[model samples]
Target: MILVTGATGRIGSEAVRLLAGRDLPTRALVRDTSRVPKDGAWSGVEVAVGDFDRPHTLDQAMRGVGTLLLISPSVPGQEIAVIDSAVRQGVQHVVKITNHKATPDSPVDRRRDHARIEAHLRASGLRYTLLGPNLLMQNLFAVAPMIKQTHGFVMSAGEGRFGMVDARDVSASAAAVAAAPAGHVGRTYLLTGPELITYADVAAELTHALGQEIEYRRITPEQHREAMVQAGLPEPVAASNAQVFGLIAEGDAAWLSDDVASLTGTSPRGLRAFVTDHVDAFR
Candidate 1:
């Protein structure tokens, strides 16, 4: 059986759907089984309750599981311990969902955490695939209301290009790696969308999709942090979030790769398509 953590999340849910459709013996590790809504499409899958904060519960969830799709929880500092527990439970193969720019020496706190997990996986002698996904197109949800409310989008990216990929495509790549042979172990895939676009280009797409004159406004990092705080995010999260844009603005996010296409056997969806599909959110 393949065990999936964070089974109710975007990538995890998508992976579970794909695995379930293939009639693969899958176990979805959720915090609360009752919280997991009933999905007739996933009736063949099993539900297991496990929390990463409590590592003792992982054994039952990982029992008889040959491979694990370990979705890193959004909470910082929890992934390494959970991965260690999973390793001790005899998980032979692991597919980790890490950030796109997570290198062995990435300065980002989350990326450092992911690097530690990768090291643990290697030391444990388990087959592992590190999936480093770029920014999610779903982040467009944040600017959606700005477009709908003021017909404008705001960011601190300042023309920095991004290769954001759709969550579905990342899930597809994860599924492929999960089903593949042992060669993928110790390999890291930098998943990205088909096109490189800036926040201004994104605004143009939204303007076209919404039939409105949406404009992109560049802001300072402090201004962006203030905006995020105004939107109800905590101070540290807002600052950290804005800091990433600062990194991108400095040209850290401009690079592109063919990992997604090579893994999923298809080009990733573009920002324009994402904006068109999610235009309702903006409206």
Candidate 2:
């Protein structure tokens, strides 16, 4: 049996869909069963009501599960609680979606948190595979409203090129790893699109997809943080987000890998493909 945490989230939802109806009995841990897609992809999959904040629920979710797909918010306690439960429940393996590289000083605050969790997981002695995806193209949806309203979006990732991947591709790669996890134990896969692209490239893609001139307005990280705060993001969250964007400006994410294709046996979706599929969001 396979159990997926954060089953209603972007990557987890897709992973559950892909894993559904497979020979392995797949289970999705969701706080609300209604959140699970009532579509063909969810067919034959079991639903386990669980919460990371509740240890007993996690234990119940792990009942008779051999492998786990751990995809949750970057809350250390949440993942740690699940990991502890997995150890206690005798789950043999884990497939985790995590930071591309979780260094202690990662500019992305979430990655810093993931670093701690990674350390704990390593110590727990559970066979695990780490799938770390680069910047998700889906993140653009956050600026979609502004793009539609003003034909432009503001960002702090100036001139820097990063291999931005589609969340769908990340989900596919992760599902592949989770489906047959033995060969992937202790491996770390850095998932990315085929090429590095800057925000200007994103704007160009959006322009072509939407049939409208789109703009990429570069701003200082401070300005970006101020804008986010004014737009109602908490000060700390906005500041951390701005810091991550600044790292992009310094060429932090300017890297590419074939790991996604290697795992999923398909090319990772590029910015153009992602923009084309979601063009209406920018319209």
Candidate 3:
């Protein structure tokens, strides 16, 4: 049996679908089971209730589960405790979804937390596979309103390009690793989209897809910080988001890698395709 945490989320749901399509007996963990899409109809999955804040519930979720996919919780500091619970429940292996740039040497506060989680996984003696996925193209949806209103995309990412994989691609790569019989244990996969794209480039695609003039507006990282603050995000989260955007602006996320295609046996989707599919959101 396989258990997927955060199964209702974008990437998680995609992972669940892929796992089920592969005929794996899958159980999804969501805070509300009602939110899980109809099995094999909407997204090909079934769900059970599990909350990260409530570790006791996890043991029930883990019963007979040999492998667990631990989706990083939105509540940042809760991973260690939740992982510990899964370990105690006799889960033989775990696949962790983590940020791409996270490393032990990373000084950024958020990446450091993921690094610590990786360390814990290493020391726990459980078989583990780490998926460090790059920036998600779905994040561009946050500018949907701006695209609809002004036909423009705005970002703190100036000249920096990102090999931003679609969330579905990330999900597919993750499911592949989770299903591996061996060879992936203790391995880390750095996943990216098939192409490197900049904000200006994305805007160009959106322009064509939406049949309107679209432009890229570059802002300072400080401006990004302020914008997040005004959006009602907590100070720390806003600052951390700004820091990650800073990494993108610095060209740290630009290199296109074939890890997604290699792992999933299919080319990851491109920015143009992503925009075209979700054009209604921008319209």
Candidate 4:
């Protein structure tokens, strides 16, 4: 059995759907039972109430699970304990959904956090696969209100391009790795879309999809942080998000990889298709 943490989240939910569709034995670990979908593709999933912060719950969630699809929580130190629990429970394999920019010198705190977890997982003696997905196209929906109001959005990622991937594709890759862990063990896959795109390019795509001239306003990192804070994000999270954009502005995330297609047997979705698919969000 494969145990999926963060099952209610974007990637995890999609992973559950794909796994269930294949008739795989899957268990989803969610902190709140109400968040679990009651019908549709979620019907066959085994829901386990678990929280990474609570070690006892994690142990219970890992019971009879041979492999784990581990989605690290936003909190920095939370994943280490969950990894420990999975190890103690004899989970043979782990497919970790990690940050693409995870390194010791990463500017973003979340990236650094993921790097630490990756190190711990590597030394834990468990068979593992690490999936580092690039910037998600779905993140653009965070500024949907701004786009609808002014036909534009603001960001700090000046001119630099990102291989923006679809979250669904990431989940599909995770499910593939979970289903067959042998060849994927110890492999680190850097997943990306078919093309690299900048925010200005995204604006043009949105313009065509929404039938309106959308603008991309480049701002300073400080200005972006202030805007995110004003938009109700916590100060630390806003700062971290601004730093990620700063890294992108420095061309840190301006690369593409075929890992998504290689793993899931399908080409990753490009920006134009993503924009067209989510046109309603912009409208």
Candidate 5:
């Protein structure tokens, strides 16, 4: 059995769908049973109510699970205990979702946390695959309201081009790794889209997709943090998000890779296609 954590999230949900589509015995670890879909692609998958904070629930969730898709929770430092549980439960392989810029000296706090998780997973002695994806295209959905209201989105990433990947593609890669763990063990894949595009380019794509003049409004990091806080994000999370944008503005995330295509046997989706698929959000 394959166990998927963060099963209700973007990447985890898609991974569960893909794996189940391939007839794999998949189990989803969800905190809230109500969040799991009752029908559609998720109809037949097993749902286990579990939490990383509550380690006792994990043993039941992980029982008979050989391969684990270890998607770290958004809360920091939660993955350490989750990995320990996986190790204790005798999970043979772990496919971890990490950041593309994760490293020991990463400037962003989130990336640093991912680096720590990667380190812990490495030392756990289980076969593992680390998927480090670049900026997610789904992140643009957060600014959909701003675009609908004023035909513009706000950001601090000025003239910095980063390979923005679709979350679905990352899920596809994860599914592939989970199904066939032989070739992927002990590998770190840097998943990215085919092109590197700046926020200005993204605005142009949105303009064309929505048939309106969409703009990318540049702001300072402090201003971005304040705007995020106004949008209901916590002050610390908003500051951390703004710092990531600052890193992007400094060209830290400006790169492309073929790892997505290599793993999933298909090219990653571009921004224009992503905008078209999510045109309703912008409208």
Candidate 6:
């Protein structure tokens, strides 16, 4: 059986859906039964109520699981705890979700944490595959209100290009790997969309899809941090957001790969399609 942590989350939920649809033995590792979705994708999937912080619960959840879909909140110890449990359970493989920019020296705390988890997973002696995806298009939803109100969005990444992928494609890739993990073990794939684009490109796509002119207002990193803080983000989180955005200006995300299509057998969606699919969020 494939046990999925963060089964209620965007990527994990979709992965579970795909696995269930394929008649794979699937179990969702949620913190409680109340968190289980009533969606049809969960029709025959087992529900294991457990918490990552609690090891005994994880051991119970892993009673007969073989493959693990490790999708956590990117917290420090959560994934490590799960990895330890997976080791004890003699799981055959793990499909971990990580960041494309993850590195030991990344300025972004989350990416650094992902790198740390990856290192630990690698040392755990378990067969593993890492899916490191670029910036997900769903991130734009955070600025939906601003776009609806002003016909524009604000960011610190002025003219920076990045391959922003759709979250569904990442989840689909994960499901594809988990369904037949032996073929993917020991591989690290950098998942990305088809093209490199800037926030200006995003705005143009939004304008064409919405039939209204949308603007992308560039701001200094400090200004972006201040704006985020004013919008109620914690000071440290706002600063971190600004820091990552600033990295885009340095072309940190101006890379592309065909890993998504290679895994899912279909091309990932582009910005124009993403904008059209989510235009209601902006409207």
The per-model lDDT (C-alpha) reads: 0.82, 0.91, 0.82, 0.91, 0.90, 0.92
Model 5 Cα lDDT, one tens digit per residue, 1-283: 9999999998999999999999999999999988887777886789999998898899889888999998855454578777788888999999999988787797778878888888888999999998989999999989999999998999999898899999999999999999999899899999888899999999999989888899999998889999999999999899999998988999988999999898989999998889989999889
- lDDT by residue (tens digit), candidate 4, 1-283: 9999989998999999999999999999998988888678776889999888899999999999999999856465678888899899999999999998788887678888898899999999999999999998889989999999988999999999899999989999999999999999799999999998899999999988888899999999999999999999999999999988988998988999989888999998898888888899889
Note the residue pairs that clash in candidate 2. Answer: none
Q: For candidate 2, write residues 1-283 as lDDT tens digits.
A: 8899988998888888888845568999999977878667788889999899999999999999999999998799999999999999999999998998798887677888999999999999999999899999899999999998899999999999999999899988988888889999999999999999999999998988888899999999999999999999999999988998999999999999999999999999888888878777788
User: What's the TM-score of every candidate structure?
Assistant: 0.93, 0.97, 0.95, 0.97, 0.97, 0.96
Error of 3 at 57 (Å): 0.5
> What is the C-alpha lDDT profile of model 1 across 1-283, one tens digit per residue?
8888888888888888888887888889999877565757567889988888887788788888889998956454466666677777887888989877655677676666666666666787778888988889988887777777788978998888888889989988888888763769788899889888888888788878878888999998899999999999989888888888999888887878899889878898898878777778888
Scored against the true structure, residue 132 in model 6 reaches a CA lDDT of 92
Provide the clashing-pair count of each candidate structure: 0, 0, 1, 0, 0, 0
For residues 1-283, what per-residue lDDT tens digits would candidate 3 score against the true structure?
8888878887888888889888888889889867867545335455678778787887788888888888965345578876788788888899999877777788688787788888888898889998888888888877887678777766788889888889999999888987873768888888888888888888889889988888988888899889888878798888888888888888889887778888888999888888888888988
Candidate 4 segments exceeding 4 Å error: none
Cα error, residue 253 of model 4, in Å, equals 0.8
Shift in Å, residue 40, candidate 1? 2.6
lDDT pick, better of 3 and 5: 5
Off by over 4 Å in 3: 42-44, 74-76
Query: Could you give me the TM-score of model 5 versus the true structure?
Result: 0.97
